[model samples]
Target: MNSLALKGNPGDGERMAIMSGRHQAFGLWGLLLLIVMAHGCAPGGSTEVGPRAPVPPVSAVGLAPDEPLRVVATTSIVADVVRNVGGDAIALTQLMPLGADPHAFESTPQDAGVISDAHVVFINGVGLEVFMDRLLASAGGNTPVVTVSDGIRLLAFAGEHADDEALADEDHGEDDPHVWFDPNNVKVWVANIESALSELDPDRATTYRENAQAYLAELDALDGWIREAVTVIPEDRRGLVIDHSVFTYFAHAYGFEQVGTITTGGSTLSQPSAREMAALQEAIVDHGVRAIFVSTTVNPRMAEQLARDTGIQVVPIYTGSLSDASGPAGTYLAFMRYDVGRIVEALR
Candidate 1:
């Protein structure tokens, strides 16, 4: 995976240059000079200058001439929702592929071109896409970035999650990016997407609003369905064992407690230490967790091993990304229903 970590490393200066959004051109001669002079000073002596494409500024509302609004969504989950709101008025591109972990996602050079071409880029944000800065810099850093998770109150990592090893190297502070797990929060996303699209192309404001309204209704229904579905699991049995803290919003909204996590934190990038694993296994047993809910994006080997040791089932749940159109959990609505059904079955 060609990813740029947000840490104080030797390559930090070079990465900073890419992120600075300079219109300077590093011609062949300049690239060679940098390679020769900054060999040991610059990290890895990278001479690759990003595309300095000039992005056109967005006009005020009502710029809709004929071409559909070009939009980019960072994750498949975000793409699905953006599609719901954009409907036929926008040309949408999804950045992440199916079942890809957002935390550890690799950004390709082609992605930079895609983002540069977009009128606006929609992301889950709140620090979910760690590689976004590099990708945006590579794209020339001119596209307007919209965070759909805005307006929703984000949660902070508490107790053991506050000290997660995955976050030790990150100054991510305490905003949980997994707000989509709660349908109520998704309603906020619908509003934000609608607002962005309407502001960009006011000619189709009514269409965007209608699409948002319909999707908002569907989201409300999903919320109610989840509320009813989780009731099948008795209150005491609502303790959940997950691979990570991805379901913090789900548990908080649905009355389930995350009894233990295999990865020991909110990110799949973190590995569990032996002592942490032992403690989690003990918690699972003590809490009487029936199943270990593993995300389809992350490796299930650790989850499977833990389940074996505890004699519990490993249930796969969609997180970060969605399945293809042909599979279960293909749409955002279907994803919630499928996960809730699995959770209900496992604990009921």
Candidate 2:
């Protein structure tokens, strides 16, 4: 996929057009109405996510004018952000397909080829793409790359994760890479994306700016709505027990308490020891936590075990990727809606 920009032909426009429009519409009407009313439907839905390994951005510098910007996203969540902001101006290849975990993902030679040839690449940054250093070390792309979450107020992850080998990769000091958990942070993603795309392909600047403005407004509305919805939960109930330390940004943004996690690492590559699980279960019971939120991309077995042992309910929601076009979380906006609604539901 060393093509610059992406090939605009969606293989099937009728399907893709409907998919695109519907995905765009997923939360617009309600979110718009919510902006006025200070409310919107709570999070609800799921989506498929990204690939197995990190690939270098494949540059397609000499492709035809009709060829869209060849962009490679480290994760599907990042891909959706670029798509919403870049619109039809670029062709994006998600290095990690839906459902693949980024924290533990490995990069292959082919993946490196994809990274090396892109005209512009969007990464979540904040050490999220642990494979990035090696990928860049290999000189994967001539494509200009930018981190969408570059200027975000990255959250500090003090908890433990599952992947130790990748732990060294997150030497990002204290900044958290899971900024998408906070809509405001994702708004930063829009800006970085729009700036990169506009600069990379000046011809599409108008489109990129226009889309970014609109998407950014939506993000703001989402943040406001979250503030409103979260108000419904009592302070004591405004706490979360998650599988990994994935919700630090989300919790921080929404005024929720991070009581702790079943696993202590930044990634889910590790398993909780019997003692760790017992401790987390005790924590849940101690806090009277109503729910344990687990990302849909991962099995909730550990969470379920903890929930059962601690008498907490496990709620499944989209954390990484949007669902297939047929499901509720078919896009980034929907992914947020799905998650926030679930959180609102269990807590309220």
Residue-level lDDT for 316 in candidate 1: 94
Cα displacement (angstroms), candidate 1, residue 141, comes to 1.0
- Residues forming the 10-long window of minimal summed lDDT in candidate 1: 1-10
Record all residue pairs in model 1 with backbone atoms less than 3 Å apart, i.e. clashing: none
Best of the candidates, TM-score: 1
| Model 2 lDDT per residue over 1-348, tens place | 322222221111011000011112223233433333211112111111223233333322455668788888888889988889888778888888777667556678788888777776677765566566666546543445676776676556633232224444644344555678888888888887887676667777799999999998998888888788778888889778887667888887778877767545455544444444555555577778899988776667667756776677899887766788788888887888888889889998
Please write out the lDDT profile of model 1 over residues 46-69, one tens digit for every residue: 323344333333343434477899
Give all candidates' CA lDDT scores: 0.72, 0.65
- Candidate 2 regions exceeding 4 Å error are 1-65, 138-141, 158-173
